[model samples]
Target: MSQKSLEEQIQQLDEQLSSSVEHQEREAKFAVEANERFARNIACFEKYYPQIATAISEYKVREDFCIHVTTTGVGNFVPKNHHAPIYGDDPISQVSAQVEYGIQHPTFSATDYTASPILEDDKRIHIRYMGALTKAFQEIQAEQKERLTVLPEHFPSAMIFGIGLGYHIDLLLEKTSFDYCFLIEPDFEVFFASLFCTDWFSIIEKVDERGGSLFFQLGADEQTFIQDLETLADDIGAFSVVRSFCYQHTPLPEIIELIQQWSSQYFRFQYGHGFFNDAITGLAHTVHLVEKNTPVLTLPKQKRVDLSTPIFIVGNGPSLDEAEEFIRENADKAIIFAAGTAIASLSKKGIDCDFHILVERPYYNYKVFGDFLPPEEYKKTNLIGLNTLYPDTTDRYKWSGVAGKGNEAGTFLLEVVSQTLNNKGIPLMPYCNPVVANTALSFAMFSGFKNIYLFGIDNGNLPTGEHHSKDSIYRNNLDDENEEGLVCMGMNGKYLPANFGGQVESNDLFMGAHFQLEKLIAHYPNRTVYNIGNGAKLKGAHPVRAEELLPLPEANRDINEQVEFLKSDFFEQFNLEEFDDTLLGVKAFNEICDHVLGLAKEPVSSVKEASDNLLRQARYVYAIRNTALHHLHHMIKGALLYYHCPMLSLLYTYTDEQFTLESYAKVNTLWQGYIIEMKEYYQHNYRTKCDHGKD
Candidate 1:
């Protein structure tokens, strides 16, 4: 036993330990744990998933522990040397304890499936569970809706959750139509069994012959599956459908759960994935904001409303029909406000709403005033909206109070003006909801309305398939047409059904607004809020039936009094120096742009160096906002976002692209040209304002 021989002996013992049952068991436990983790991720799949089994088997496990093929009439070896279950004693059982909706892989039991001697007329051999595979075929037949309707031809891509012996997959290919099919089989053993049991080669050839795409994600973790899905989704370019299938008597609950969770997350990502685009769009709107001299008001010096004043916010939901009479009878009892297009509905009914809260800036939205109301109606009601609102709509109101747009772009523009003019811009409201209802709600909160009653704020449609009250533009448009889409959860956690035979639809406009309103109301516990509607539920707001709302005391307030207060507080009085600040600010911004242009032309060796320099230039441009040049800083901020973010993205994404001096020159030239154009436009405005003299 020399030193070399002793080392060899130790190596041999190490090899034996690695091959021991304890090591194998630990590995099996790790696999089970991984599967469990995957199962947990699957529990939150989309609501659109099928509720029935959809898989069938092409191979059978006989009593002899061999895979008996029905498709190819072949027998294959399934390793059974390790008698211990690969997944554990109860693989599918753990899924029940883990998730509300999840799938667990069935245990590999040879005795469970029985082989049949009889063959179909097509010469296909028969496999069975207790002598017949009728139940499996029947399960798939019940899920014809999923294969045919849910995974329709319209969707270019299809994601299959369970590949249980490839039965459901076979039906999906032959029964339905799609450009591509993505098979996600989470269980390695199940997929392996399918390979040995079925004629997968012929299936692939058939799919290829049809000129359709087929991708397989086998035994993948959550991350791997998600990444594959994302790439597939990107390639498919939207409308990628997802469906789940489980084999009869051998369902893959874990995989089904995974698909569910994936679909939910994918939808969430799609919903809120627009930061850079928003900034770009906001920059475009900032130009419109300045051109109109839209009376961009900063916050008033003091709160206008008494915090105790009861306020009623009226929406255009169908529930408003019932509230119309109550609002009319007690018109003066509370500070009545109409949100978004609700103004049209209330005005059509001859109900005098005190304030028309208009937050949306679209030209189409302004039709609520143009198409629905007369000029007299617009004049009578006070208008409160974002400063970024269309000037055509805002100018119609005799008394208007504007708040900052509340987005990053709107805030940037307002903040720059505030810094330059030494006037604190109107209080910024959170535009978290993409809908005008939330805008009205934000303004209500801004005006110090404590006890607020929301009327017709039904975030959904009525039973008659009406989204808005009669006389509304929405109702008028859909009067003769029947279309479906827009689904939101009801108060009872089930889908709110519509009269048109589908779930009540909720677009981004309503959903975003509802969520924002919920958050806003949640902040104030003592301030009582009531939703006087039977539409979509608003959490944290007590529901008050329209009939229950009583009218009593006359309001001590008048519209003119509030109108005068708003004008006196928010109206901007101009001076000559302020005009000079605008001119000088534009000059300073151009100078910074020129400086950055010069930097871009300088030789840079690495992507990091170029990116760092560009970023530094962006920061320097941003810093100029703090100076007297701040009047034009809004444009500077916009320019910085436009240039900086894309540059950073390119830097990270295309690090391998060699930074050429010529490329820098091209980019610098582009920005320089854009800034010059903006400067000339501002110069024209400055000259015109200068000629107008003091106002």
Candidate 2:
């Protein structure tokens, strides 16, 4: 057929779809038939289990959800350990129940990796028919029985596995427990078939809140599954696979090795060196790969013991000067967790650190404290940052102090410190912004500290004229003597000195800061983060102005009036530390540069292996890039949809081929404000001044 004719015919067909009376009648008939068929199916199911008809009728399933054949038995049946296996009560409601559930909230869209063009049309690949799967399941079941021995005698109290349809799960439940299962399937056609399984099945859904998407997604291709496995492995602590999902792609031996490494690392992440640390000798090399270019976390770490211990997270706010005496007096009673920049000031005051965290994100001065210290002190302080942040830090602190992502380290510290001491460090952040306050407070919670007292949290700007603006506290060229003192690094009229932004309101945005602080203070009941001077704004007395917002003495203030705050940083902090239980993680993180710079040296991979590996790693990269794109597809689209972001403007116009994962992460972080803005529309909690392509 001619190209023009082909195009015209397609267009005609599209018109016919919209215009034909016959089509409308057919659609109406189809709808009617579908409703009838569904009614009959429900009737049939009720008939099969008339005794529990009420329970069956009460079974609730979300509307407009597609059911995946894989997740059919999730909620319908209960596992052994669960007590009251209500559908989707929480992820692993009670591990002891025999019933399990699967529920997902998919926000970003995802798809499978591309495969051979020939495979696209293969009837066998579509999985529409189950004869093959039936046979495959039969064989796998026997194998599963053998593998079952490897599993503990007690299966999880309740188990939730994703079933593409009910076939695999239906058969499995027949062999096991059913009264406690709850299924979640994303495909409607598949869901209906499974729901017909008597009173044994309850179906839920995975909805994508970002309008057209779901919070979780399945891999589209073999490559997608591999990538998904890696992501799943990251959180499992120790695991070889995501419980129910299957990967059809046959990975190379090396890729399998990577999987093994992932399993090992996850083991370390959970069981620690007891399982895989010494089994793999290149721990130092792995640590090196992960340490580079990460951000400094403003995370707070405190020991747990006694009923209460005060903590102070010193920020470089001018108020640090006034609070000095109080910190000096109570420094020993509470741990002083210094923000990277304030460590110098705290150190100069002879305040020792029981816990020190560095949220060294590159965008901020991640290495602000790195260069300031002499070589020996490397072992003295604990270095931390967001795992996302550390990808960019230089390899300076290896084997000396622990270098874990703030998110991960924070969770560990919370657990560890909570058991060790009674007193905790008080959070003393300087930024007036709510995000900063929230971040700092979240870190405190994770570090085992409760009952935090707020200090140096001048959420507003520095006093009328005595702010960091006047002198130069934030100069990039800060020396050892300077971390505690100010060194000017300001633009002539950019900040302080009244010329900044040419508006008094700009300088007065501290009110906005206070507004945010107030909101932040409302969230945590266990915390106390109030402005001591009743948020007094200082007049022009610079030095004298510093006294307006220092720490408040507990002996004098009304206990109830102390402001408290809370926020969830779980996704970042917990996810990071969870990886440390495995030495595999350390090996996985090591790079050649890492081994060369610090710690125990390791041999490089063979040149041939490197080349061949890069080829597959390239594939992994493609999967990562595509997955990220899928996750942020809405945001990327919005970047262009709204012309407000210049970076997105440049990014959107770049060649499509150039949009690799490495490039995407960098560019996205570089111009994050626009991206963050787009993400906020999806995740209401996402807020960042510059991350969302604000400019």
Query: What is the number of backbone collisions in each predicted candidate, taken in the order shown?
Result: 16, 123
What TM-score does model 1 achieve against the real structure? 0.48
Deviation in angstroms for 181 in model 1? Answer: 32
Each model's RMSD to truth, in Å? 20.3, 22.9
lDDT of 2 by residue, 1-695 (tens): 89999999999998887766554564555446445555654664464445334444665554633321112222233322334322343222232232221211111111111111222222321121122323323332333221211211111112222333233443333333211122323223334434433222222111111111111222122223323433433332111111222111122343344334333322121211111111111122223332321222223342223224555666545555656667676655554556555656566666654434444332235344555556555455444333223322334443112223221222233233223332332232322222233345445544445545444444333434333321223543444564554463332232222212222222223433333343334434455433332123322112222244345344332211211111112111222322233422222222311321221111223322222222232223224223312222211222221121221112222223133222333332322333233223322211111121112
Best by lDDT: 1
lDDT of 1 by residue, 1-695 (tens): 79999999999998888757554565555445434533332331111121210122223444555333222222223333433322323333332332212123311101111122323332111111111233322332343321121222222345566665554455445544444566777765566555433445556667677655676766666645665565554333222322222123123456666755664444322333222223333443444455555555555667564556677889878888878878888776677778877887787798877778875554545653575677877898777776546555667876665667643444465566666566554456654356667877776675556778888777776545566677565634453456332222332222443322445456544555665677677655566787875766666777778888878465556644654555566554322232223333446655765676666556667654665566556556556544555434444454444344333333332212343323444455555554455545543342221110111
List where candidate 1 sits over 4 angstroms from the true fold: 1-305, 360-368, 408-425, 475-504, 556-695
Superposed Cα RMSD, model 1: 20.3
Q: Per-model C-alpha lDDT, please?
A: 0.52, 0.32
lDDT score, candidate 2, position 34: 47
